[model samples]
Every structure is written in C-alpha cells, then in structure tokens.
Target: MQILLVGAGLSGAVIGRKLAEAGHSCRIIDARSHIGGNCHTERDADTGVMMHVYGPHIFHTDDQEVWNYVNGFAEFLPFQNRVKSTTQGAVYSLPINLLTINQFFGKTMRPDEARDFIAGQADRTIEDPQNFEEQALRFVGRDLYEAFFKGYTEKQWGCAPTELPASILKRLPVRFNYDDNYFFHRFQGMPKDGYTPMIAAIMDHPNITVQLDTPYSADMTATVDHVFWSGPLDGFFGYDLGRLGYRTLDFERFTHDGDYQGCAVMNYGDRDVPWTRITEHKHFSPWEIHDGSVCYREYSRAAGPQDIPYYPIRLVKEKALLADYIARARATEGVTFVGRLGTYRYLDMDVTIREAMDTADAFLNCARRGTAPPAFVTSPD
Candidate 1:
C-alpha cells in the first residue's frame, strides 16, 4: 500500500508510523518547512529553555496506554499544571476551588460551605441553559463567571458566551476542594527534552519519507493508493461549503531576567485586557533550571485566510457547513481524514495521538479485509 499523509502533525506522523510498520509505503508531507504542526518545540536561542512554537501544550492524560506510547519516544518529568487567573485587578486560582473562593470573597469557608455558597450563587431560575453565559450562570453564578470566565471566554472564542455552546463550560473543572491540579488526568507531565525531537524521532522510519515543503493536493489524487489528510477538513475540499470558523492565536514574545508571570499559564479575565493568557515557557518544564525566562502573551482572534488554524469554533452555522464537507468527504474515495483539522475539533495532544492510533488500526484492518477505510475516524457532528 502506498499512503500519502498530508499535514505532518502528530496525527500524520503517528498514522504514518503505524502504516509503515504495517508494511505500507508512506510519504508524509507538510506545508510548513518543519514538521510537528502546532506541537513543534525548539530550544530558545537566548535562554535555552524549551519553547512551544504555537502555544503551551502540557501532556496530561488519564489513559495509561497513551502515556506509555508517548513515553516510549521521550522521558517525561512529573509536572502538575497550576494555572492562575488575573481578573478584577487581582490574582486568583482557577476552577473555583476552595482556596480561590475563600480568597476572592475574603472569607475562610470550609469545603462544604463553599460548595453550598457557590450553588446558591448560581442562577436557579435557569432551568435549561442555552449558551455559555447561561450555562456558567447555572453552574457557577454571575460573579465567578464574570470575574474568571466571561471576559476570557469572549477573548478566546471571539464571541459572547451567549453565542457559544454550553458543552464547553461543562468540561471545565469546578471543584470545592483546595486541590489546584488543573486537569483530572491521571498522568501529568512534560517531555524531558521537547516535543519537536520526540516527533522527529517518530517520523524517522525506514519506509516513511517526510516532505516538509510539499503540500498534498488533487494533483496527486490518482497517484497514491490512499490519502491520510490531517489538514483542515475545509482545506481538503477547498472550503466549497464556506470556511469553517477557527480561533487562532497571536503570541507576543518577551524575555525577562527571571520569573515574568511567576506561573506557567495566567488567564487574563478582563475584556479590557486584550490577551487571553500569558505562558511562561520556563515553568512548563520546571525540571530545567534557567536564570532568565521567556514568556508569550497569547492573543486570540478569528483565523484569517493565511493564519494557522488553532481552535475550531464549530458553532451551529459552522456545523452546518461541516456537514456539507462530511457528505462530500464520504462520497470521495481513497481518503481517511484524521486529527484535529480532519475532525474539525479542538483536541489535546494525547487525544490527537489516540485518534491517529485508532485510525491506523482501523484503516489497516479494513485494508486487510479488502475494504475501504471510512472517511473519518471521528466525526464532530
């Protein structure tokens, strides 16, 4: 089997590896000069600290299988993601935890009392929440929502909370305990080296040939036996149904002598504040010692024609457009769409890898059975 993988991101790299191991000849191509997509990391020339070229991607997952798979490539150091929010002109912890609630209200309340208090603050009248605003009001009340989430959400999504879906707010952790571990994942850590080297190792295979400057297209539509596209789903069809909405980031880089923000990630929760968050790359891998630190103030905006697509804003309107692409992709032959862009969803690094693994497994199975692989491994709709 001859496979041509577009977009040399984690999805493309992982799937390419699997296919090559399964005795397929795969050639992975990426539009960017380098591979690893958004997860690309490199050592800072000035400080020598590992830098996230796109944004901060902390590897945290509950799946032992995913953890083990990544560990096979690079050693991971135990790291807990402790996030802070700068809002109402003050610093506070996130996830509405006990310490955060007590600090915000200037009261020393117990766990049960804080939980009950927050519940009381929530909008009891909202029997059925519609948008992000109403959902947050129903879950954590107006005060917390406004101070911590409202402005940040607006900036991040480029829309008012009322215009967004409630499901997003549901994934956010809201805890009564004092615990401040940002994610509920069982395994939480940073790659000992960096993501770039790890991904490079993955792409270094006998049968896999990576073409960095080349982009996949209809020109070779008949050349390869199958195409594993990890680029934007809309990009694949040339946005015939209209461009899928995406929120892209703008990073304002700065170098400070020591401890710029004093944290890995700081959420700026004021509409007045332009940037959504500031990430101190040094803190991401605290195992590394550096005298000076580099930081990125992240600004989110609607993705432009040339901007790198980050988060998929799959709203109702975009969902309808995606449905058209889905239909078109299904009708198309010899293509298996995988990864964040293919599925048109915002996914963590681990989820992206897991999906690619599943895709390769299923595709291989179908091939062995002399059948066609499905248009998608995961569907947003």
Candidate 2:
C-alpha cells in the first residue's frame, strides 16, 4: 500500500515507520521545512548549544516502550524536570509539593501536618465545583491556587479559571509529599542529541520518503491507499463545522552571558505577570554547559491562523465542533486522523507515539483481510 503520512511529527513518523517495516510503501510530508513538528531541535549556529526551535520539549515518559523506542536512535541522558515558579514576589518549586507548602505559608509543617493543614484550608462553601478556579479552591484553597495555577492558566489559555473546565486542574498534582517530579511517567530522559536526530532516524526507513515543506491535501486521497493525518481535524474538512479552538504560544528568545533562570522552567503565576513561563534550554541537559545561555519567555495567547497551535483548547463549543468533524471523517473514506492536532487534545509525546503505533497495527490487520481501514483509528472528541 502506498500510504501518505501527513505531518512528519512523532505520530506521523511512528506510524509511517511501522507500516513501511511491514513491507508497505509510505511517503511522509510535513508543512514545516523540518521533520519533527514541534519537537524540532537543532544546535545553535553561533554558540553550538542545542536549541529547541518550538520552545523546550522535555521528553519525560513513564512508558518503557516509548523510552526504548526513542533511545534506539539517540542515547538518552538521565534528566529530571525540576520546574520553579515566580509569583507573589518569589520563586518556588512547582506542583505545590511540601517545599512549596512550607515556603508559601512561612511554616515548618511536615508531610502529614501539611496535608491536614491544607485540607483545613479548602473552601468549605464550594461543594460542587464547576470550573478550574472553584476546583482549586475546593481542593487546595485560595492562596495556593491563586499563587500557582490561576494567573498562569489564565495567561496560557487566555481565559479566567472560571471559564476553563475542571479537567485541566485535575491533571495537576497537589501532593502531600516533597516529590517535585512534574511528570509521574515511568520513563523520562532527554535525547542525547536532541529531538531532531531522533525523529530523522525514525523517518529514515528505506521505504519512507519524507518531503519537507509538503502538506497532504484532500485531493491526494484518490491516489493513495490510505492517509494518516496528523494535522488539525478541522483543517482536514476545511472547517465546515467551524474552527475548533486552539491555544498558540508566543516565544520571545533571548541570550545572556551565563545562566538566567535557576531551573529549566520557571512559571509566573501572578495575574499581573504577562508571560506564563521562561524556559532555559541548556538546563534541560545539566551535564552540558556553555559560556553563554539562551532562554525563551513563553507567553500563551489566543491562537491565530498564522501562529503555531501548541494545544487544542477543548472547550465546550470546540468539543461540539470536534464531534461534527469526527462524524464527517467517519463518513469520508481512505483516511485515519491521529495525534494531537488530529484529535485536538493536549497529548504528551509518549501518548502520541503509542496511539500511532496502535493505529498502524489496526490498519495492517484490516488491509490483510481485504477490508477498508476505518476512517479514524480513535475519536477526536
């Protein structure tokens, strides 16, 4: 089968490789000049430091297969993501762990006492939490929520916590202990040479031909046996159901003589602060150091058509539009929509890879039995 894989991101590359390895011909196309979508990385021409083109992407995954698969291309270095935040006139550890609890309240409460104290702090009135602000107030109380999530989230999503869904807060941690690992993934590491080489290796299969600056259009469906689309689901149907909302990022890159922020990621949680976070790419790889340092101040904003979409804002109305697209995609033939953009979800790199692998396996099974592949391997909604 001559399969056309759209968007040369991790998801597209993974599925393309699997199908090609199984004796099928595959062609990978990307809108960008590079292979890796947002995960694209390259060495700085002037300083020789590894630069994350689309801001910083720290590959932290609990999935052993994801770790092993990525490692096959580039040896990964042991890296732990220790994020800090600047809010209310101070820098503090993230995830609101024990350290944050003690520092925030100016007390010396231990793990158990901190848990009890915070439980006491919860807003007793909010019995049924509806939005993010209410959920945070009910769970961790006002001071912590306002200090940590409220402002940062508002800046990131371009809306107050009350407008956002509670599911967003549910993803964050309010730990009783001092464990500050931002991610609970079983396997986590930075690629030895950065993400670009790894993704290039993934797409370097004999039967796969990658076309940079190439985008797969609906008209091409007539020639190809199947299309694996990793672009936005709404884009595939020309937004006939209306554009699903997405949150794009605005990065302001700067360079300095030495280190800037103490940690890799330091978020600004105060509502008065304009930017959400500042990322120092060098800190992602602690073992390496340079005389100068580079950083990006990332500000989240309402996505425009020209800006790169970082996350799908799966609000109520957007979810409804996504459902319509899913139905339209199901009715369409010879295409499977997979990955973050296709599904319109905030997918970590690991989940994207795992789902792509599964999607490819299912496609192969149906193809061998002379059956048509499903319009979508998974639902975007």
Candidate 3:
C-alpha cells in the first residue's frame, strides 16, 4: 500500500515508520523544510546550545510504553521542569506550592497549615464552579488567582478567565507541598540530541520516503491508497466553513553572556509585561555546559494564515466550527485525521504518539482484513 502521511511531525513520522516497517510504502510530506514540525530543535551556531526552535517542549508522560518508544530514537536526559513566575515585584515558584504560599503571605506554614489556610481562603459559597475564574476562586481563592493566574491567563489566552472553561484551569495543580515540579508525570525527560534528530530517526526506514518543503493537496490524495493528515483540521478543507480559532506564539530571540534567567522557564504573570514568558534555551539541556546562553521572549496572539498555529482556542464558538470540520473529515474517504491540529485539541507529546501508534495499528489491521480504516481512531468530539 502506498500511504500518504501529511505533516512530518511525530504523528506522521511514527505512523509512517510503523506502516513502512509492516511492508507498506509511505510518502510523508511536510510544508516546512524541517521534519519535526513545531517540536523542531537545533544547536545554536554561536553558543552551541541546543535550541528548541518552536518553543520549550519538555517530554513528560506517565505512559511507560510511550517513554520507552521515544527512547529507541534518541537518548533522553533526566530533566524536571521547575518553572518560576514573576508577579508584582517578587519571584516565586509555580503551581502555587507551599514555598510560594509562604513566600507570598510572609508566613512559614507547613504543608498541613498551608492546606488549611488555602482552604479558608477558598470561596465556599460557590458550590458549583462554571468557568476558569470560578474554578480558581473555588480551588486556590482570589489572592493566588489574581497574583499568578489572572494576568497570565489574560495575556496567554487573550481573554478573561470568566469566559474560559473550568477545564483549562483544572489541569493546573495547587500543591500543598514544596514540590515545585511543573508536571506530575511519572516519566519526565528531554531528548539529548533534540527533537529534530529523534523524529528523523523515527522516519528513517527503507520503505519510508520523506518529502520536506512539500505541502499535501486534495488532488495528491488520489495518488495514494490512504492519506493520514496531521495538519490543521480546517486547513485540509481550505477553511470553507470558517477559520477555527487558534493562538499562535511569536518568539523574540536574544543571546546573553553566561546566564540570563537562571531558570529554563520564567513566566511573567503581570499583565504589564508584554510577553508571557522568557525561556533560557541552554537551561533545557543542563548536561551541556556553555559560556553563552540563548533565550526567547514568547508572545501569544490569534493565529494568522501565515503564522504557525500553536494552541487551539477551543472555546464555545470554535467548538461549533470544529464540529463542522469533524463532520466533513468523517465523510471524506481515504483520509485519517490524527494529532493535535488534526483533532483541534491541546495534546501532550505522549498522547500524540500513542494515538499515532494506535492509528497505524488500526490501519494495518483494516488492510489485512481488506477493509477501510475509520477517519479517526480517536474522535475529535
């Protein structure tokens, strides 16, 4: 079978590799010159630091299967994402941990004491929280929300927290303990050689032919037995219904002597601060020693046609638009939609890879039985 895997990111690369290994030929096409899509990483020519081209992507997942699978491609170094935030005039640890709580309140409270204090601060009147604001008020109360989340959320999403869904804030943790690790995943690490080489390694197979700087078209779909699209859901259809809402990121790069931020990610919670966060690229790979450091001041905004879509703004309005695209995708034959952009969801790296592997398995099974694979292994809805 001659399979066409569009978008040479993790989804397409993983699925294409699987199909190719199973004696099926794959022609993977990517619009960008590079293969890793948004997760593309390369070493800085001047500083020799491994720079995350799109943004900082820390590979953290509880799935051992997914963890082991990625390890096959590149060596992963132990990296814990300890994020710091600047608000008002002081710098504090993220996730509102006990340290942050004590620092913010000027009190040395233990885990139990801090937990009770936070509980007392929480709004007990709001029985059922609706939006992000209500959820924050109910969980961590107004003080922490306003100090850390409010301004940051406003700048990040370009909307009021009251308008956003509770699920958005639900993912964030309010730790009572002093553990300041951003993610609570069992397995957390980064690719030693960066994501680009790892993805290239994954796509390196005899039967797989990757065509970089090539965009997939509806006309080209006729040439292949099946088409697995990992591009934007609305983009596949030329946005005939309407463009789905997406928040893109603009990075301002700057090099510095020695250390700049001292941390990998320093989030600016103050609304006055134009950029949301500044990431020191060298800190991402702590193992590598460099005299000079590279950093990026990230700014988020509504994705334009030319901009690379980062986060899908799946608000009520965009969900309706996505539903129409999902319907169109389901009806389209010889096409399987996979990954973040294809499904219009904010997916972590592990979830994307797991879904892609499952998609490939389903496709191979269907081929063996002389049947057609479904449009989506995991439903967008």
Best by TM-score: 3
- Residue 280 alpha-carbon offset, candidate 2, angstroms: 0.6
Candidate 2 regions with alpha-carbon error over 4 angstroms: none
Ten contiguous residues with the weakest lDDT in model 1:
167-176
With candidate 2 superimposed using the best TM-score fit, by how many Å does residue 151's alpha carbon deviate from the native?
0.9
Instruction: Give candidate 1's root-mean-square deviation (CA, Å).
Output: 1.1
lDDT of each: 0.89, 0.86, 0.93
Q: Report how far residue 162 has shifted in candidate 3, in Å.
A: 0.7
Residues 1-381, model 2: lDDT tens digits: 899999999998999999999999998998889889999999877666788889888787777887788888888998888889999998888778999999999999988999899989889798878998988899988888888888888898888889988777664357778899987777788988899899889988899999988766767878788898899888988877778888888889888888887788999988887888899888887889787888898888888877788888888888777778888988988888899988888888888888998899999999889898887777665
Structure candidate 1, residue pairs in collision: none
Across 239-272, the per-residue lDDT of candidate 1 in tens digits comes to 8778999989999999999888889999999999
Model 2 TM: 0.97
Off by over 4 Å in 1: 171-173
**Residue-wise C-alpha lDDT for candidate 3, range 182-213, written one tens digit per residue:** 99899999999899999999999999999988
In order of lDDT, best first, we have 3, 1, 2
Prediction 3 global C-alpha lDDT: 0.93
Clashes of each: 0, 4, 0
Looking at candidate 2, the ten consecutive residues that score lowest on lDDT are 167-176
